[model samples]
Target: MIRWDWIGRNLPEIRELLGDHIVMALLPILLGLLIALPLGLASVRWRRLYQPTVGIMNVVYSLPSLAVFIVLIPITGLAEQATVIVPLTFYALAVLIPSVVDGIASVPTHVRQSAVAMGFGPMRRLLQVDLPIAVPVVLAGVRVATVSSISLVSVGALVGRGGLGYLFIDGWQRQFPTPIVVGIVLILLLALAADGLLVVAQRLLTPWARARSSA
Candidate 1:
């Protein structure tokens, strides 16, 4: 209601900022998925490292996002501050790693034994047998991480990284309603859109599970 012209007219800028924030949020989550999947598979293999590694990621994930941004500045510096992507990546481990482990572990022992009996090697068993079965659950974790990162990355703008948070800061200092409203709305929409996409992806990834779930 407060002179809506700024936001109404400047939608393109809002869209760009939202897009960049979403992309930045996603990069870390994707990287986390890459790093987490191997370690999770390894956890099921080595057994000894599972507790320690998962615990560490859990701790990292628990830390405040603001704290992470501040902590990163000392090492990475402001010019390249957007690199808070690393902690965001690390923050995903608690949910993703555990989900990957649980998903693999959930597969009934008989299926694995049957695969091995049919001459599949350990690697093949994982890829063709275990992982396929695990996909449905691992994906759930990825979805959670993806959504959380989307919301959290707005804080990245605090470090001059240029996210929707920039709008938030500008809105506050200038006492303008447009930047604040647009930033909040954009971030919310981005989170919802990402969550919806992950759900669609999960359906695509596990047709059999969907069928079974429906039945």
Candidate 2:
């Protein structure tokens, strides 16, 4: 059912599509992280803000991707990729904020007190002590966001920027199984690759955790 010959012949196009897919997925995550960092930090700093902030993020993230794209057409129009990226960014936020909040909360109270006793400023304590310990947990959330965004990017195809979803659309329209199969396989590969890289990065960044586990 797979047209390996077609895939073999179309390596360049497939590569381009894959590249688009990667961008579509990663851009949202980067933007989302930028927006989430401050908000997540604030939420942790002010315990009362956490509930309301997360509620809003959940509502925004719950909106269907396709519906978001459609709603943005009037403002962003269909020409720019913002129509896709914005919604995905919100989705990424929904996941990242919780991860950040939980990660920061998980840091022991003594650690905070010790940092303060050492005369570490709030910013320095947060950046030097708290953030490093939270990396593993935050990175786990990033992994989730990455995979979700990668899969969700295909939904953008309906608005004409589906990346690999283009293959799916074309395959479906032509009743050819190869392109559909190729699209599915490529997306799976992308998700796996992203997750694998995140895992490696987490281990690299948190060597203390690795040492503790090994011991």
Candidate 3:
């Protein structure tokens, strides 16, 4: 049987660090979602914002991870920048931006027509009709972003950050396998747990949409 002592001993420390990592990872994604969602909405709504914003996000996403970290270190400090938001936001784009755009765009034209027929105001229509219908698609993006970010959060630990990556790195450097195994296993469990939760969330929120999507 596999020993559980290392995991037991490290639980508090691991939880604390992972908490920080999750916080760091979440802010950028949330901020990016705030920016990317509106712009993505406008992109499909107005067309003018789509090409340029998409292009920019694509470029940012394309940059190599190490290269982005290297460039960011000077401006944000070696310890903080590489450790948290810079890389977190970069990884968020491919999922967040496109998904927001697609989710908004997927709002059928006839639905808009119905909103207009009912004389619903722009914001009213969006909140009551469009967004509700679009939520499943948006949730799909969040699922992707969250899982990817969880793993990347480990990467953040590389340059003196928090999360399980610290365990992996320190374990490697010290020539011990306990922390390494525990860390890797915990991170994997985190990702799996997150994915499972989202699956439940999607089913709960988009029960009707699931049939439509599957059909």
Candidate 4:
């Protein structure tokens, strides 16, 4: 049985924890994007480096989040947020790099030719033509990264910073199920909300795609 009364009484705390959870899940994503963008672009431009770079990132992603967090504690200290953020960022990078490369590659050959015919340089063609077309694909990766980060942040609670995951731990130790259930539900809602927002943002950013879909 669930306790709505307990949940109602704890609404304020739940709200605060939800905010923390959002930050915990979101900050690493933003940081990872900043890092992934240039690397992804370089992978596309360099051609030969693509597979090797992606392979290395996949190796990093294979590392368990708990292990990464524990490993970072020695360097960043247990209380430092970097212990959690760094691992989540690496995970984000793994998904993003390949998506970016493929997204850019998916650009039509005729589009590239037309850009070159218009006297666009490599940089201009990439920025003006290729990246715009790649937005949907890149965003698809972002949605995955976000949901994964949200789930992984719970593991960070073990190190003292898991946002909603802390609630799960607290509930388990106290023999209470309300907080644990609430935390699970809230995390799911948060992931769905984040994903939905990304979809809306993609439509806004790529009006041409919206128009094409309507047609």
Q: Give the winner by TM-score.
A: 2
What global local distance difference test value does model 4 have? 0.90
* TM agreement with the true structure for every prediction: 0.92, 0.97, 0.88, 0.95
Each model's lDDT comes to 0.83, 0.90, 0.77, 0.90
Report the lDDT tens digits of candidate 4 across residue range 9-97: 98998998888888878999999889888999888889998989988998998998998899899898885677788889899999988
Off by over 4 Å in 2: none
RMSD of 3: 2.6
Q: Candidate 3 — which residues are off by over 4 angstroms?
A: 1-3, 81-83, 210-215
* Cα lDDT tens digits for candidate 2, 90-209: 899999999998888888999989999999999999999999988988998999999999999998888888789889889989999999899999999999999999999999999998
Error of 2 at 198 (Å): 0.4
After superposition, candidate 1 runs with Cα above 4 Å error: 79-81, 213-215
- Please give, for residues 84-176, the per-residue lDDT of candidate 1 as tens digits: 687788887777899999999989999989998999999899888998899878988988888888878778777887578788888889988
Pitting candidate 1 against candidate 4, the one with the higher TM-score is 4
Clashing pairs in 1: none
